[model samples]
Target: MTVVTLARPDDADALSAFAETAFRHTFGHIYDPADLASFLTGWNPPDRIRAQLADPDWTIALVRGDGGAILGFVKLGPIDFDLPAGQPSEDATELHQLYVDHEAKGSGVAAALMEWGIAWARTRAAILYLSVFTENPRAQAFYRRYGFVDVGRNPFRVGNHIDEDRIWRLDL
Candidate 1:
């Protein structure tokens, strides 16, 4: 069984470690090692995650399994990026990252995190949005199941490489 909880300040280290492992498990094969390393270093650093945990605008929720090990996490927050014209600029929230460990796949962790994120968004914004790599069809399909519709495309940067990512939005 797994339980979901808001990440605490002390969870910074564990969250950082789990995030790196989960990211590598999902996208390691898609990017060059150098690029992947650079992205991980900047994105999952313990200090960065710890700071985020302290930010009121961000919510970092974690899914813990047996022995209280983190199985997955979701980071949701107010929109900080520029949305294309026609996309509502106000009352927008972003599901910045949703990552699950490989072993936790098919165990309902992702679904739980997403459910919490959407519920949280309902109280905070009019719409919830997320960006998934264009090549990740499985993720796109999963988002579609939750009523997220494609709105546009955006450039996602991993280190110095730019990749196209499909933007999906769910109106709450």
Candidate 2:
């Protein structure tokens, strides 16, 4: 079984490296390699991830394989963290990012990360929410398996242009 732990600031480099590799595998085909590289570099660059790692409240949960390899991680925070103007009800948890190494795929790592996040959030309140790209139906379906229901839609800027995102929330 994989054990999930609270990630410390020092883990930023490893996390960023994982994001780079996993991101390339996940989206390189959908976009020009150059575009994907540029996008990923800018978004999850060492500097950026390091800054987030230093945040006082932002949380990152990481899971490691039995041999100690990183399998997956989930970034979560108060709804207000990612959404500047997002005013959720009293009980709302925002999922910022979730990714698992491809080799660890289909091993229930993602579900375990989500479960960790939801349980952690429940300690803070009663609802869990997340926003995912409108184009990624696979992820939408995956979220559904955890009982997350689509509730609304909005456009969020990625790189330059805005893209549609579906909001899903589960009542705790």
Candidate 3:
């Protein structure tokens, strides 16, 4: 069985590795190798993960398989991206990253992590926001099922490549 729990500083290395692998499996084909490598090191490095784990404002939940391998994870934190005018940016939270190992894709891991994310966000703010690649229909549909609607377009930078991402919002 898989279990979801709060991430600790000690889990940073494993989380960082899993995050890079999951991201590469999902989107590596779209970027040049150098860009992908740069993005991984800059964004998912162990030191960064450790820092976030130690920060009070950030929450990371990991789904661990029976043998303690990381199967998935989700990150929640204060909104860092621009929000549309009139939106409650000050009190809003963001679902920064939600990823599942490729082998766990059809095993309901994502849903479990998302459920945890939404519940966790409810305690922090009234609004929850996230971004999804515009070309990713599967992810878009999943967010829609959770009542997250597209509110605007945001540019997501992965190294030097900019992807047109749709900003999604859910009223918690």
Q: Estimate each model's TM-score.
A: 0.95, 0.82, 0.96
Taking the tens digit of each residue's C-alpha lDDT, what string does model 3 give over 52-164? 88888899998988888999999999888887766778678999999999988879899999999999999989999999999899899999999999999889988899999
Which residue pairs in model 2 clash with each other? none
For each candidate, the alpha-carbon lDDT, in order, equals 0.88, 0.77, 0.91
When summed lDDT is taken over every stretch of 10 residues in candidate 1, the lowest stretch is: 76-85
TM-score, candidate number 1: 0.95
Better of 1 and 3 by lDDT: 3
What is the number of backbone collisions in each predicted candidate, taken in the order shown?
A: 0, 0, 0
lDDT of 2 by residue, 110-132 (tens): 98898898888878768787888
Candidate 1 lDDT, 1-172, residue by residue in tens:
4577999989999999988888888788888899999988888788888888899888999988878888899999877666777999588899999998888788899999999989988888999988889999989988999999988888988877888987889999
Off by over 4 Å in 1: none
Estimate the lDDT of model 3: 0.91
Residue 22's lDDT within candidate 1 is 80
